[model samples]
Target: MDKPDLTRITTLLLDADGTLFPSEEPAFGASAAVTQAFADRFGLTGDFSAEHLRRTTTGKNFRTTAQDLLSRRGISVDSAELEMWVAREKEEVTSHLGEVLLPHPGVLAALRTLNRRYRLAVVSSSALTRLAACFTASGLDHLLPPADRFSAEDSLPVPTSKPDPAIYQSALARLGIEPQQAVALEDSATGVESAVSAGITTVGMVQFVPPGERGDRTAQLEQAGAVWVTESWDRLARDLADSTVVVRT
Candidate 1:
């Protein structure tokens, strides 16, 4: 992979779910709960595992992911019903917020260090409420406050989710930076696609990916256009510091 031209990146846009907040367990659990609820409601007999949830729903918006889940069970529903199911899933996930969400190791420190030199923002497919829950849980709420946060909820009347570039474009417009002047950190192929499509140099984060699947995951992110793939925030922090030196000289 080519070295990223970090010198031009004055702002950083981060993906929350797998990148900043690593508590994917609860997210998966919530999806499972909602899927099961639908299954029970429809009298379907198959089970949904966390792995299945992670694989299918990780980078998608709630509506899209939920629709995918329902489709897997040979069921189909209209927008209103899908929205209702999504609401239930959000409620179920919110109830277990504390147990399912936490910051990744070294992430807080990296954020603190990076915040000193670059503007930081969160761009997520997650709803604003759930994003707030994770940010509050991880104590990242203060660092990337509301003004600097953009969620699916903010992507109104446009392409409303990741892999669409609308959210990233909105964030860039708000931050007053060009896409070439920013770097995006993301953990899923879906997010990588979104960032890359938005014209930002993107780094694929793999710290939260299971050890056995990381290699394949790395390949996936690369295929989706991540310029770099890393498993350690500490290492990324150091690289950023080094990049600053290059920028100065």
Candidate 2:
């Protein structure tokens, strides 16, 4: 997990929900509807916005965010809640999830280009099933080829999820890679923290911009140790490509 490790980084760890697609809006509109249903089912009041879930979790990891969010609201839920919500609401909002979070343009090209040189892996803290559906729906799953996509369910009895570094570590281990030989792309504070802590190079993709100046996220992400931050998928590809060059040099 040192500088030399980065030079040989041939693994690319990716966050699915927010990073592969976009944030600020639901990947599947149904998620929002289902989320509201949960809020209502729990008798919780107010609109809970995790618009920047991806960008924020990039530092901490997704598990920490989910548990912390629940603890904050006194809501005793687990990662399973997300899966349940998706199963129940997906049918209703299938169009939204399928439509709203369209793949970032040129991302497939980036994936394809990098795939030739890097062993790409999807390391999400979300449920694997749900992510697989979204990826399939968006055609990203097809574009992803045979790369390994890791979620909370596959590793640990649920280590509180992301921002914990557990998923990243699991993905790397599963791929027989070392931390220093991997670079993770995250879109959330939680994710950033997790990857950095794991000693992997972390790049923050600011996929979600707070509504109407409600927050300053980029600065916080940078402070959280995000080595790179940008909105363009192309820039992200180029920045990461440079890492490969670093390795070869």
Candidate 3:
């Protein structure tokens, strides 16, 4: 990949779930039961366990994951039923996250520094309500208010999930900037792919990942087109500071 043009970057697009906080376990854990119930109702087979759900659908909204699973089984739900399940899953997941979510260590300070010079926005595959719940629970709602948050599941005319560039494209359009003028922070392969496909340079943030698994996750993000991988938000903040300063000089 070519080097990222840090000097030109005026916006920072952040992925919320694993990037800003550790919501994957609680969020996916809450989703597993709902997913299994849906599967049982439709006779869809294979794993819908929490671990499997996290692994397969970390960067996707529950609605998209459910639809994909059903489509694979040649089963399609009408809009009403689909919307019902989506709302149920979202309610469960958001409630669970509200009780357990916490911002990653150093993230608040890192974002404080990053915000001074960059326009920061959250772009995610989650529904807007779920995203708001997470941000609110983690005390990050103030940093990214409703207007600065873009959701693939709620912000678009038709819902989509990551690995689809729609959300990133939408954020760029809303911000009135070219893709090159933004940098994306993502923690999942799908998230990285989404940003990269939108022509934004991506950095992988893996601090929330388990220590033993970070290396693998880093490689996964790199293969998905991340230009850089950082283990912590503090490090990323420092690097961006240095790079932007160097460019200015």
RMSD of each: 2.8, 4.7, 2.1
Per TM-score, the best of the predicted structures is 3
**Cα lDDT, model 2, residue 238:** 74
Task: Write candidate 1's Cα lDDT for 1-249 as tens digits.
Answer: 777667777887989887887667678866787787776776666556777778866787667766565677788777777678878877677667755666654889988888888888899987777777888888887788988889864455542678878888888887788888888998899999999998999998998888898999999999999888988788778878887532311
Model 2, runs deviating above 4 Å: 1-5, 49-70, 73-95, 99-104, 153-155, 207-215, 243-249
Please rank every candidate by TM-score, starting with the best.
Answer: 3, 1, 2
Please report the TM-score between candidate 2 and the true structure. 0.74
Ranking by lDDT: 3, 1, 2
Q: Of the candidates numbered 2 and 3, which has the greater lDDT value?
A: 3
lDDT of 1 at 110: 88
Deviation (Å) of 74 in candidate 2: 4.7
lDDT of 2 by residue, 1-249 (tens): 122335566777887766776533554333455555566776666554444433333333233543455667888865577556545643544445655555555777777777767777888765555566667765677656435787764456654566677777777777887887787887777678878888888877765454443246666667777776767567767766665343321
lDDT (tens digit, per residue) of candidate 3 on 87-158: 999999999999898765599999988888888899999999899889988889878999999999999999
Candidates' C-alpha lDDT = 0.79, 0.62, 0.90
Task: State TM-scores per candidate.
Answer: 0.89, 0.74, 0.96
Once fitted onto the true fold, the runs of candidate 1 whose alpha carbons sit more than 4 angstroms away are 39-47, 69-76, 103-105, 245-249
User: So what's the TM-score on candidate 3?
Assistant: 0.96
Query: RMSD to the native, candidate 3?
Result: 2.1
Best by lDDT: 3
